[model samples]
Target chain A: MRKGGVVVRDVDSEVLQEVVVLRFLRNLFRRKDTVEYLREAWRTKPSIAVAEKLFHRLQDTGSPGAALAFIREAGRAYPHAQRLRDLQHQALRVRSSEEVKSLRAALAANPRPEIYARLGELYRYLGHCEEALEIAREGIARYPQSGGNYLAIGLVHYSRFLKTSSAHDGLQTEACLRQAYALDSASFKSLYYLACLYVYAGAKPMASECIARLAELMPGDNRVADLAQRAQALPDSPQGTAADYFRLHEARAMEAAAGAPGRAEPFAGLRPGKPLNDRLARIAALPGVDGVCVLDRYGARIAGAGRSGDTACNEAALQGMLEGARVNARRMSIGNFSRAVLRSKDWQVFLYELEPYGLAVMGGRTARQDLVQRKVTEFIEECLCEEQGA
Target chain B: MKRILKELNRTAGIRGSMVMTQDGIMVAAALGPDLVEDVVAALASALLTTVKRSFNQIAAGESLSELVLTATDGKMVFLDLGNAYLVVVAKRDLALASTMVEIQSAAHRIKNRRASTVQRQTAAAR
Candidate 1:
């Protein structure tokens, strides 16, 4: 989902499934009477799953502090429930929207000046600029000399200015960036963000000046270079906007759907399609065939045919290819990655990066995984060496 | 996953290896015995979002392919594997460049295989 002009996709469901499963079974076993019955069954011959069942239950009840004390008890041995709780909680909670809520309470507690500074950050993350300002104000009022407090206020104003399009808001944004600059002359983070604000807000020269100063402050940092590259490369129209990436996404989705067994049985000699499926038909008839496809960056359809089981339905496979190109060159100590191969349950993807983008091949036949790899590599090299080959 | 952890710990000088989704799910992880998966997943998700925000702020785009954190104890490297992330924590005593190279190569292999599978399926559908 896109919010505040930024697209945020839903969390992967597979991991959620596991957590849900844990919760479900925990519920089944935690009934007051059953806990006693199972506690005895677990004594004679304790099972790992059963032990874990009781262990996870304690976490939800927040009785981990006491449960852990019994971890050394034999049979239905309790787990280091508290430790598990701490680890699980840390892994899950930090980035959640709840951070904003907790920080609200943290603000109410007024625990310490540091607490307020942190709470101010939480408010900004939740996009609660007004709340952030109020929190920062109180902190600053308590400690006017604290640079972090000033920085927090600056962030809220700058954030609001960016979100709102009115002329009034624009002025407000400028005022905030200025206040931020005056209050924290030594903070490059404030200066750098101000530079971005300037660039997006149409103050290019001022943006450049701010960037130059930021660069001076952190000469070793590559962030400025990275930002400059991306900004300059921005696409011009909807055709080129991030949405255009779906061309490739659709092609991939199609391939996966075709591979679905419910769609069609495998054709011995020919797959059904105007033409694209013919090449796939021939390959399918070959022994040990599962599924197949060819693709390029941007998720466009190129050609071919297959079973949904044989195809890759997961969009992450596309991302994996792009990442492969990056890691191959960086980690392999190789000067470049002309082609690469990826293997997983029931499928394989072979990708060859070309100028601007690249081509990819997917199939489920793992009988000769190496051959597929070689073919992809050769095809890529041929295309590059002689355009006529493609 | 065990083999991967062993390899990183040995050849790549990784102190730990974790597999997590961009949206705060822990798919797999091998950390210190004291650590727990849910905790790792949660903390990593928070950290991942923070990094992604940084990437967006810098105009480097919406995704973060990798991130490296250096501390007194060692180095931690994050590899963006599309929907999932591979996190490698290296001992401070290890050389940064060498370990990074090893982890990078491994990540490449994993991504390439995944892409090939997707491409094959895409082709059949067309």
Candidate 2:
């Protein structure tokens, strides 16, 4: 026999007969009998084609879970099969969609707080932030005392905060989680999320308090322990009270919201001209400085001095580090990440965040830290002044 | 080892201190009520791993020597001690010049003590 342009060796007669019967039954619209026989055939002598057909039949018969289970089993049996892997992925997506459809239908039939929370969580997990936020907010409006909706809201905002590093999102996440905690202090999910938020925000004392409480609630839970460990590693939020940090960020957010062209958009109008390039070159020429590059928020090189290739490479690397640093800083509820000095035995890289742009200065190990810092600070101030003046 | 950390913590503006292997295993720690030893060790290790990886990519062969993260709330100083590291958690207003001297002294003493103990162990085996 030939299959998909490939010659196949002689097949087992019994297996072939079973496939023939299964195909005939499926053709006659005997899906139930066909699935039964397919299952029996699979147990007796499993084949990829038979498993695929069975999976389709099961899915058509409204048994997604069984279809998924059978497909997974087939996947395990044929670990190297790309077709099975694809089918498995398809089954998962189908299952999730079906679940959402059913949940929505049920919710329409009878709106409930728990249903709203579940659907919101599902939407959030699916990356539908707007829908998740809407559903969560709706749930909150209907069931003002329910902590689950607040948790859903907090989680959605937390994910947004992670992506945008927006202090506004972080503050919203904190507020929602805090409200959730207040509604039910002993709730494990609320405490866990609250602990996680504190750890990220670099609120050590607060995280510790949450972790301690969680420990009391559930002794020896690995999650609590892991959280406890993470809380230990939190960098101190740059010197400021949490209130002060949030207030500063809030004011900046407000400014941005009001179309004030806040610090983050300082160079919105000014293109990278010769003067800017000259300034970068001068910074690069400073004693011990090897290279200097300015990068826009999107990690695009705005202006700098160096071999183009080297600058691009440095820009990509520095941008990634800068992003990581920004997220970390925001997580810790630190107002803003102004600068970082990364030193190794042979090199020292200074990174500065000038709102809309990032500045990277590469230097030798012997670079005078104080001089480099002062010059960079002065250079950045000068650029901002020039841009603002322009 | 704890004594060394305790001594280091006595420095003004230093909130707490710990000595841990490069992988973040706690060797010794002298911390205040606000600090937890295992948590600090794990957190330090996690941060070091990230910093070391980032540094390697930027400057291929050079190993990180020190990492000083000055955040709004406080400062954390991580000093490389060959196989181990010294992590000092200090107030943001810490006098870097004076506090670093104490931290370096503590790190040196830890290294010396380890060396002497290894030498003594070699002699006993012989």
Candidate 3:
């Protein structure tokens, strides 16, 4: 496979590494005493697989949330183990049951910040604001230093703002998000919410700063583009804060989780751009067009074809050209970016801002633009169809 | 002067903060015991200069207003102060948007004070 103009030749070797790891884990898992085997494996190899197996075994006893509680409790005992930290991080995303009983039980067993954070978020998600606030207050009091707790509190306040459209709740949301970001600037959840909050508050400068950082954290994520466009569209202090933006984000996330038309579709089954690459190859085989390149919202190359020699089109250069044109288009107050045609001494580059992705087709200047445009449109529509079908 | 930074530090998850001149001379710092004040000041100065230079390179006449570096271990934020720069070392998961606003406000307060001081000096000289 070619990535960034370089051929990746280690596919077999990488597959072998995965196979070896699973095989080793399978032998250990097949043992009569699984718990002891996990302990021994954790003490020896200390791999992610060991932690995963432990989490799985704990899941057999109860919910994944309960499994996480057990892992976190075990982590306290094995403080020096690196795998424990890995497990702790993984525990944040683990979902089991959001029912009041399960949450309260998990909280009673392990009153750690992770449980508080999860319970608080679940409460907020379920529209139990009072319960969420209670959990947030208790968590903050217990783990004042934990950023995740602050993030939960911030999220709960944000929920309030969305519900009541009260300026007080909005301000509280801002303060809480600030505190959460202060506690951990690297938290994507905090950064993302803060950016969206700023958008609603009509603080474009601050929103842009947050979105830029988020772009760095989650490169190629389509949501960043959506958030950025929404942020830019927001007028400072618009009548009735567009609460629907947050709901849109939530709806998209729910869709993504359900294997609908979202980022997950591109990455879940096939490697990103694997399907796109197949389409690009067909475009490359077309006469006149020298190469076809696709870039994500952040101008990072998703996939490319051609450029086998010095005279062929380079993906990175094409990406830069498209980005420059995009910035210029925004600066000029162009309603929206449609197409850019760059005539160069070597190649004629055609750029199109496909929603969530950038498309660049480089060909000889004499190449038919009419034919190329049709082909590009056909390719984009087909890719969109694939995502919808997926 | 120190009170402003101290109040900022009282916020949850802020590990340390430092104020330094453009030349990297440390003016004040409320850093943790493990961090060296002068070293952090120097690094902050270097990061600011490098970032500003890059911005200038990309778009002439443009200067950097702020910079945030997030690492797995922690986060560092630099806000451009008129006569100096404020560098804050925070937790990796710090709420960056609010923190940036707080830092920017602090820098604005410092700038206002300096402007008032200069005005008073001018009146006194007259």
Candidate 4:
């Protein structure tokens, strides 16, 4: 039930609050016929419930669009209601590919990670590992606290490991799998992914941990449990594709950067042939790139522009942006926006994803947005390519 | 009418201008980009009518403040300001977060001016 990779949360808070207030207000009104007032609240409450039932019914009949329309209209009539949203989630299962595309149109106001995770699954099911990897990364970025998000990220990497050996980034892939394990060792998806990584990395002990955890949580998730058992049953040695599988990633990155706007615009104030300075220059001059800096995924700035010398806060802001971008893309379906532009009258931060490395573009409030997106998109894709090459 | 609207647009970041009859006729207007001031000035009455309904629901025993409609075009905002005018501000790619601060500022200043002007004219006639 994925539409534009948005995950509807368990409840809509505004609606619950409003409904409670309405009940209190009705009670406070003086001299109304007892049955009349109670009946009115009852009538109003079920009006929303009826909408939910109708939406679910439509979804059951394979009409997610109609269900969504029903929910939207119900939401307008009852803007502060949780049940209406619950009903919308129920209809998500009936969605079609076209509905998923339309859901992207609503990403600006969309903030659901559950949808992103589901979208990743759908893509993976369709054998689109690259897309699945991209969105799963985005999903994890937004909701690091979500066990589901972590599993999605791990699954992408594990799947990559199963693919072309020369097309995956093992170091970053392991990091992603670790995060998945950190959140929920018992998750079937995470255990499956972890088993794959462990067998690949030749770390049977870690593989055993994943197996034990899976047994505790699912008890009958024998597929991964059995895989872990098989790895243990065999020698604790690694054997798979000869070359590393990070080449394709690097190629994709290069393709993206080479295609970036202002490809050779003097790297924006920084001259070429200056060591990593050229990399910094290239990052800055990227279209939609507001500013540039390098960092680990944990937000430790290595090098770049616009630091103002406050390394501590700059790093914190960078990490926050990375997480925020992931969440933003998942919730809104903006298509893997590790690059974000947070602007007020005061400050702004732009974050971009580049595998084990992170690229951040930040500036004052007056930074040009279009120029920044184009540039950051270029740099991110390029960085991914470079990291894979290394 | 042109003079009255001149004062509104020249106030600050007023990019477009218009004047409307209570029945939604365009007395005079100036607009920019793809927007037509007369058409918006006509819709302005309908928007005001919506505001009137909300006002009635409140039972505040006070007057209506102002009506504002805000929109985006991927990069900036096409903000409909005041009951008669629509101002389209070129903002960030994400218009909501970008133009909101500016739109709110513009709305507050113009709302006070228009509300007080209507009150003053009504009082003068009395």
Candidate 5:
């Protein structure tokens, strides 16, 4: 049987028939805003499952960027909602191919502020600085109040500054970053970049200010700690004034640009469809592997995959143990605690500190701990290199 | 304690500060009305206790000078003061090093004052 000229074999038996009806009406009336309003209504309700389903539908209809925007709107009502936060992270970790296709399609079909910003980020990540800047400008033009677009523009300019050592570019980057921070003080990206730019500019006080804000935004972040250390290391007195420093920096930038050499694209070997979690899952699938996880400096699991019965308990234990090691290291004046390996007759456990994050691997006694460690290091290097390369 | 905390708050980004006993009692605080000083004290005390235990178990030595906890909304720094702890709440962008230095100085003053008062009480008893 058919209703409203659409096949409906079990419309009455559907779980969210209202969604189906809404979609039908939306299609019939060709009114996108009506459906968006309904989606907003659904968001106000505390239904994670429905929200997840609608999120998937939104992704299917639009793109990950669109899905991100929808979830961001939903997030206002449920600020501390964990699932929504996880979904947002998932959207950000989009497979490259899928992201590119969807972003292009989304922009072509119906461009929105988030799509433009995200696309600009992807371009920046891929080292297409010119394209990234163009997209950022378009995004700014479309969404004047959007701090993220400004951040993207700032990042692009910062990257150029790194390449050419241009004082003008550095100033532009700083201004854009400051604007971004002014608009949205809560964002870690803007604050982090501002701190970094300040440090490079030898503005210790300003750098310290940015670092403090970043620490609050992402507590226990190693990057913030590193910036803090750098700020502390700056001398109380400098030889030159601000103008003189910029002039010197410009001279150096010109010299470096004149000797420009070919370099590989950032994220050179990072193919689409393989995120850090997927990579960990692959490692877990190796023979004799019991469990593997990626953790932050604080020992909180960023992602993990395992066959072990007590994965959560093991991770928690490791976290506590790592904290103990760090404390001991600090007391002993032994510098940073990099790695710890525990081997017993039954199993072997390995923990490595990948700055800003940690990698924990555990397996049976007969397992290839060496190979696992190598793989972990390689994966970590790839991520770091991607970040630095960009 | 109020005077010290108020002075600390004069520095930009310092939200508030409090003094709490090791047993989780709130001695004094300069926090805002929206914040429950007692609850913060209790949580800080509990966290410090956990840190101490972790240190003991690891044999990392006895002197646990301070604790810093970073969260999304704010940062908390707990300075150990023998019988009590000083908890400082500040925004993410606050100058942490200088603030820590200021707190340590204030903590020293509190300890000395308490020590002198204890000595006077002992003399009176004699």
Candidate 6:
């Protein structure tokens, strides 16, 4: 039998009979008791079909949080169930929209500073930059001393700065964040954003000061430590903008989703169109390029082409080199480790951090480093574009 | 040797300079107040040791002539000498192309100084 678009085979007859009874009860009474019964049935039987039905019933009953929880649990148990994951994402979007609507209603009924700040932050998270800015401006106009509104404004401009790399946006971000910090020196968010801004702007002294303040505030916090490490490893010339950073993170999340035993069409736009190996192969074919490989943070080869005969050994060595560089860079408080060039008599090896993955390209010593760097940039851009278009 | 490091430290944006063995032992250092001599030496040694091991594992009979690590806040350049490595730490804005000349010159002077000292020891023994 087909129910809720999920095939109902392999289900026990007793369970199916119970589900039928619950459906009848739901249709007749539409009571909370019916939902309880469905939940009980799901907990007892725990089949994919039942889980889907339970999720729909939960949503109908206006318990999206419960529905999301159930769907996520089902997703983990039945990793092959793409339908559940889709429903989960759908539920999240619906829930967020519903909350937004309610929050808007609440603000319309009674305008308040916190609400405006919150709405602005929500809009920012949703990538509604204009709306976020508008809301934050409203909040600032009413509650000029509210650091939250200033932070929201700063973040919107920071996101814009990341996207546009405009000097004005950068300046606006700095000004807003500085105002926020001045309003509340002990605010963790304020300090964190200031530190991130300084680090990106290559203002090492300012970045270091903010980081030091954060360390004092949260002495044992791992995030503070991570921030410190990032400060040390920052590249001399930081590249990419907010869009690039978010896209890479989104791509990684989708990759994890793809790993589950299900179709990943929901994230099709962010999935890579071509296999990474094919892309690496194209890079290897570049003139004077000896080899190319992508290694995970741990140094495991994710993909490669034109590698030497001792691929395993070479990968291990590369991993070791990356680790050492990362450690040293952090200890020195440089920024964040971006890239390194290893030179020998016969070859030059370039290693780049692509966040969760690292790209290593080996080229003959005769190759123009600038040309090789350009090719690598092209390859990275292609990967990002393919992911966005896929 | 210390004088060479001190001179190298004078270069714009260079915070400190040091000479260390592949094993992480500090021979000499001219570091800024913000830098600790022991910490810098230890870190440099650890990095060089790892790089050297990587080269050995490849077994390609190739030795690293130079390594440059560029971070967001600063940059470190390592030049291989026969017996020790010269490690220089500078700010991110360090004009590497222009500053490398002075750095290389300082490395050369250190190498020459070591060579002369070895020669003097050999002559004394004879």
Error of 2 at B58 (Å): 2.2
Candidate order (lDDT): 6, 2, 5, 3, 1, 4
Q: Write one digit per residue (lDDT tens) for candidate 6, span B8-98.
A: 8888889999998877788899989988988888888888888767865653768887888887578999998878989999987676778
Which candidate has the highest DockQ of all? 6
lDDT of 6 at A221: 86
The Cα error of candidate 2 at residue A194, in Å, is 37
Q: Which of 2 and 5 is ahead in lDDT? A: 2
Candidate 2 lDDT over A193-215, as tens digits, reads 87776665566777788899999
Q: Which digits, one per residue and each the tens of the lDDT, describe model 6 over residues A1-390?
A: 888999878668878999999999877887533677778877888888888888999898888999888888888989866456556655765676677788899999998888888888777655455668878998899989888888898988876554334456667887888898888777788788777766655555667788999999889888778778878886543455533433443454557545644333322221333456665776788787888887766677877878566888889988887887777788778866767888888777887766546788887777566666655654554454343331
DockQ of each: 0.01, 0.14, 0.01, 0.01, 0.01, 0.34
Evaluate chain B of model 4: give its TM-score.
Answer: 0.47
**Off by more than 4 A, model 5:** A1-149, A152-318, A321-390, B61-63
By TM-score, is 1 or 3 better?
3
Q: Per-candidate TM vs. native?
A: 0.28, 0.48, 0.32, 0.28, 0.34, 0.50
lDDT of 6 at A145: 87
Could you give the DockQ of candidate 2? 0.14
Off by over 4 Å in 1: A1-113, A230-390, B1-126
Which scores better on lDDT, 3 or 6? 6
| CA displacement after TM-score superposition, residue A390 of candidate 5 (Å) | 5.2
Q: Write the per-residue lDDT of candidate 5 for residues A41-62, one digit (tens) a residue.
A: 4856546655666677777776
Instruction: List the global CA lDDT of all models.
Output: 0.52, 0.74, 0.64, 0.51, 0.66, 0.75
B40-122, model 4: which lDDT tens digit per residue? 55445554443334332222233333222222111212223345443332212333343356555654555566788899999
Q: Candidate 2 - CAPRI tier?
A: incorrect
Off by over 4 Å in 3: A1-390
* lDDT at residue B19 of model 5 (Cα atoms): 87
A162-269, model 3: which lDDT tens digit per residue? 423345556777778889888887788998998877775566677888899999999988888889998879765433333444444345544654563334424221
Q: lDDT tens digits, residues A1-390, model 1? A: 899999876678767988999999987776643445546655766765555455455445565543443333422243433233322332223333455667667757765676677777666644444557778788878976665666677666654443222234345445555666676688777777776655545454555677778878888678787555544554333333211222333343346446634222211122224443543444444444444454434433344444433133322344344444544343322233344444334444444443223444445435364454334333332222222111
| Stretches > 4 Å off in candidate 2 | A1-264, A267-271, A306-309, A328-336, A387-390
Compose the digit string of candidate 4's lDDT tens values, residues A241-294. Answer: 313324433454445445534222112222223434545665566543445677
